[model samples]
Target: MESSSNSKAKPRSEVLKIMEGLAQELYAQIERGEEPVLEIPSRTLSNTVWDPKRRIVVLGPDKLKRRLLDMKESKRFMQTILMLKLIVSSIREGVYPTIRDLYYNGKHTITFRVPNVGAVRENTWDEQAESNAAIEDLEVGLNVLREEMGLSADVKGKVVGPIVVRSKGFEIDATRMGDTALGLPPNPDELDIVKIEASYVLVVEKDAIFQRLNREGYWNRENAILITARGMPDRATRKFVRRLNEDYKLPVYVLTDSDPYGYYIYSVYKSGSIKLSYESERLATPDAKFIGVTTSDIINYKISSDYVIAANERDIKRAEELVRYPWFQSEAWQKEINLFLKMKKKVEIEALSTHGLKFLHDYLLEKIHSGKWIE
Candidate 1:
């Protein structure tokens, strides 16, 4: 499907202008006999910092200088330039290409001979990782999201709620989708959120649970929007949740299993992940709450011991790492992680079914209404 003409025009012009500016800088440098360089913010773990005030991870003040004349940086510089050209060409041609499509489009072998050395062959990029890195570099360097450049990625989020959104000139009402849901687009920012009539947003970690709640009409009764990314969330899901909270002032409550992995999912939604800290400003929902299946619930809710799973070494290690995150330093989170470590036991949200299948609805209402969630 085509994007709405009005929405497409602005992003196309804006991104092209930014790309043009980068090209102009390089051309002027070459004309003056100076080596051209691109200074992009360093996207290293060491350069990712937690902002205490903003309550989110952000890229630190370190920059990498990619100089065309430097041997070590030349290939990466070339890759970035090639990606820029490909993206610019796509924008001009009005064709949206996925990252994988760009990777194959740009992949080719170059051969050249050196003194006393036979012909040497090198690939433009050995793998998708290399190509994706270049795309990310362009994102940081140009201060533009790949979505703005008409790039697409696999979208994995779906929602059912009292929300109405307009995408590509088509209006979608989540409440009217019946057993299905409104599939989130790759770029949620491009969606025109026309209306929201929900008291809160319920973000379920597992798609099955999301489906159960949707099918049971849990959202309709609670006046909530139900969303799920299936597992670890993608940028579109995170961004869409952030918009719901930031723009519409809806409280976001994440429901996950009572384990380290589940906690980490909530962390990614609320505080942003370490690797993609640069996107936190647009993606993280600082006010999102963790509402369920906490380690303590295992005992409080009288979940059957048979439903409990012993915390594996990996789970313990992940919980330890989470304790060190700045956002997880809250008193409630501290207590929860410490308890998980001490008990070395975990439980799933389905364990609540020990009471009844419909008990999940009661549990959700209890958490939100009683203010029994951790930040």
Candidate 2:
């Protein structure tokens, strides 16, 4: 099985050599008048296999080759070439550019030639999504992630807790670092842990929850580290959480709103997304438990119906799909999902505010203390 690659990346020289070699091979193929083809793993569920025990989604060996000569592959071929050149240039210059930076860097080159009109500039991706797809293609083609290719994205997560990190050669305690926990740098592949007095780590799905906990000094009282992805987690935040769990052997628990999207967020932390399944094992927090604000919580807490939202067709569809996932095939998870299906209602973490703002704070503490959580 293809396990995930950790953030403790190989030396830049070594990674650069691999990327350069790929570029050279493509160059040699063109020199010989042969159409260059890039073989990348297909990013589909049919091409992915899940390891339930490991809680990781790994890629299969089946590969899809993008050839330059095909009409369908023409745009992708151009995208591949542009991204590959950028990767090589970035590596040669020893600069790690984020996905956004690369999109802008190559935005000008997004031109197509017309038979009568020379080169016509076309507006291709209004955002970085296209650039990201090209990056992933390179990942599967080279059997290395974009990060391993020495590329990263702007950090989009935060942490607030009583843990000290020796990052970039400085000892900083996250707890005493004001309201916002030290924001992780864009490139956290080299973060070194110094000291952690926390008993466990709590990964909140939203920033509001993290801020509330910080305001109440929950971390101080519980002796736990608090982290939030602010929504769906980015690679850096996931890697950082995995590091804390693996390095410190601290129990990691996730808290998310009791909704399909929220559950998916928890799943992203527990098991990496299928889009980036190649790096699942390294980034996924397999041991992290879900200390949820489940549908059951509404009844358990005696929350009023006004606080609950009726599940729409879209919500039900998503929930149904989630239940069929291999990782979610558990007695506890099935029960929770069934409850949602039967009641046709979902609850957000904020619903706890209905009881009282402090109710959520106390509820989380109670669950953690009593060991009430689902896998």
Candidate 3:
């Protein structure tokens, strides 16, 4: 049975001790490139960079003394001993651990004596080994995920600060004084944003397109600088886009593909998560507009044989439903939907030739800069 005093029972002081160990373990896990669990009372205590004083107060000194005393001198029956754990992370302002080599790579294989209730000596090793095994598995999984995602660049380089209490769930962090994420895009109308006379900004989903534009020198040098969503658009991306208007006073043009997946991506960027709609709606990038690969484009531009890739039944159903959705019910969307029902095809941005896309690039640049594209 779960404790009735779950929320209230968690003292602030106990929250600190649980988090300090959690911070150590989480640091170990991330060093191995794993997703560390950030549960409370840790999130409550050490979420935003570690302050040994204020945050750690989640567990009071008295509460920790009681818990520690219960573990130490109580050879007697003190039946209830639940341990709270945390994984505290400090971005740049953390003391780097002096990693001691494991016995059999002991730094990786953590073996410690955890004193729990109803044990012969002080505790049990059976559950200890199992829990330690879980950490090992998590570490290995993180390593594999990094390699698979080609995120070695990020995993090795990305710095985390301290986790703080936001109204929503988790953010990067702020435990120490000076450990902020440098890559964080500025708030709208903040500094470092350059104003462009061009009206439109092209936001792409992949790095390849942005890299290609720079390498090929295809984009309007002064009109549009490319922005990559880095896969999915997040708070960071939305912040950046919101700024193009409020900061740089530029209109936006989003260009992706005519695929069902790309349609969903544009929808999410415009209106936020479809499933988590209520919670995520506010996070949506309200400043951008969609501009390519409509259903009509798929049919008019699509080659039936090559464009008709085997879309899953789910995707087909989603495409149909998307057409009916109020947001995409405009004439441009309706025409696209009708064509989709007929050909059931998709069009990729790649399908647009260098010459063809260059024309679009020029058209979009002209429209944006001329103030004709602003809604």
Candidate 1: C-alpha RMSD to true structure equals 3.3
lDDT of 2 by residue, 201-299 (tens): 999998978888898888888899888879999988888888777766789999998888888898888887776788786788888889998878878
Instruction: For candidate 1, give the lDDT of residue 220.
Output: 91
Q: Per-residue error at 113 for model 3, in Å?
A: 20
Instruction: Assess every candidate by TM-score.
Output: 0.93, 0.84, 0.47
Residue 317 in candidate 2, Cα distance off native in Å: 2.5
- The CA lDDT at 292 in model 3 is 62
Q: lDDT: which is higher, 1 or 2?
A: 1
State the lDDT of candidate 1 residue by residue for 1-375, as single tens digits: 222233222366788989988988988999999999999999999999888999998899999999999999999998998888898888888889999999999999989897899899999999999999999999898778887787888889999999988887999999999999999998887887777889999999999999999999899999899999998999889988988887777899999999999999999999888878888877899999999789889878988789999999999999999999999999999999999999999999888998988898899999999999998
lDDT of 3 by residue, 144-182 (tens): 111111111221111112112121232323222242222
User: Residue 144: error of model 1 in Å?
Assistant: 1.0
Residue pairs with clashing backbones, model 2: none
Model 1 worst lDDT run, 10 consecutive residues: 1-10
| lDDT of all predictions | 0.89, 0.81, 0.42
- Per the 3 Å backbone cut-off, how many clashing residue pairs does candidate 1 have? 0
